[model samples]
Target: MIVTEIEEFSEIRVRARAYLCFLLQRYIPNYVPEPSLDNIINALKILKKELPQAEAFYILDKKGMQIIDAISNNSEYRRGKGINRSMRAYYYRAVREKRCILTDPYPSLLSHNLTVTASYPVYDDNKQLAFIICVDISLKDLLKLFHPSSIDSYFGHFTKISYSFFSLALLIVAILLLMKGVGSFFIMAFELRHINIKEIFESTILITLSLAIFDLVKTLFEEEVLGRHKKREASDIHKTMIRFLGSIVIALSIEALMLVFKFAIIDPQKIMFAVYLIGAVTLLLFGLSFYLKSISNIKEEE
Candidate 1:
């Protein structure tokens, strides 16, 4: 999965670079020494028709101040005049390096969507930097342009469907377990008249296990099958693991406590085994908690 995502990103970057070069070649020759309003308007029209994905086009002076704002007619957002972008990495890199560059994805100030900026340095007759031409491309559009084949899309759909089926199966199992636990409790309470504490303890463990299984299945359905999450990041993985482990720890602790109580009342000699079990589970819980915390801290630093 990681390798596939990396390859897709690399391919998109190459395609975006090529697209930016084509625009630079076609538009640079139309530059006038002292561009008038008509020149800017005509250039904007040509760019709008040629590059449909480009959100906006900018002509920035040597100092990285907007000289011409040829906002795309199809775009709902527009930029104000004379906005200084000298400190922006894209502006600095294009101006200093004198090369066409594609920027990493960032939130667009206009529409607040993820966007990538392709910048090219425009030089005048004296071979000095005259202006920087920038084209804004929405990340959504860029990804769609280089989207995977239908086979991959179909495979993804299949995976989600499989997850949904698996989750439904788990839900059915959980419900059956819950009904069994309830039946066991009723039998102990009414039929047996609560003579055996062990039976009650067993019923409680069954109920807890059933609830835990149901919780896990619900989480899987929401996160995987239903696509409730946008993407699974490091934090999401960490949280999922922590929740799963915590549930197990809680269930084990409850079972151990019940064992200890039963042993204390019936056979005190076997209480040592329950003590050891509780100690081991407690140690594991502490270790897992510490490990998760350290991992979370490291990811935050990164």
Candidate 2:
């Protein structure tokens, strides 16, 4: 029962956030003479007539229905304050949490300026809640994130089977390239079998493609992923340095292994190994240069 109640509350919040985003992004900027509740409402009404699609936006004062930017388009729409005469759930949540909230149902006559509101509590330079950003939102736009349409629903199923098959084939090819690179690098260095450089390059390409796909997946569901403040850990910079060192070491290890094979096994030649030495040394120098530059900058700041 408690879980259900929490879910219901969450739904309401999204609607509010949506409304807030709508107003702030689209209508709020029009009122340039210092932002206020009355000006915000006036901007919405102007937007509704000009744009027609914007008639759904609104605002509320302490008195019930203190201001609705629009109420004429919909038949059941009624303007002015409703029964409640205090701070709304949306307003209270923003003031309390200091975070943007986008909940369900949206700013509708049913809930009376409740619904999806995207609101951020505005803070003055002195760090006080001067106002709350409220936006009326569309619920349909939000739901497309969590439960996307199935493949069948997306492409009409078997009719687009060939497209799916083609993608699968590409994925398989990428995997093969990665495997070949890994196998070549391992074998050439392991004294086991012939190492193929072509395979290694193919693997690298596939790995890059796979990472791109993963990034795209994150992009598709980004709305839900927002709200959390990105708190960079103390170790972020340290780990970044370590990863840079590791990449250099591993890449050299691969090239060195190949050089050992080319000169020791196939033929006695110093030329092939010389470039590898230069690159390894150059990478180390690059890291050192960056470290020195950072130190210099810090000292200047101090």
lDDT by candidate, in order shown: 0.73, 0.48
Model 2 per-residue lDDT tens digits across residues 81-187: 44342356666766567665554454555444423445544444556545454544333333322213222133223423654455555556656655665665666
Which candidate has the highest lDDT of all? 1
Candidate 2 runs further than 4 Å off: 1-45, 51-62, 65-81, 89-174, 181-245, 264-266, 275-302
Candidate 1 ranges beyond 4 A from true positions? 1-44, 75-79, 124-126, 147-173, 193-302
Best by TM-score: 1
lDDT per residue as tens, model 1, 61-86: 78989876557755455554688999
- Which residue pairs in candidate 1 collide? none
**lDDT score for residue 139 of model 1:** 68
Question: What's the lDDT for residue 272 in model 1?
Answer: 96
lDDT of 1 at 7: 40
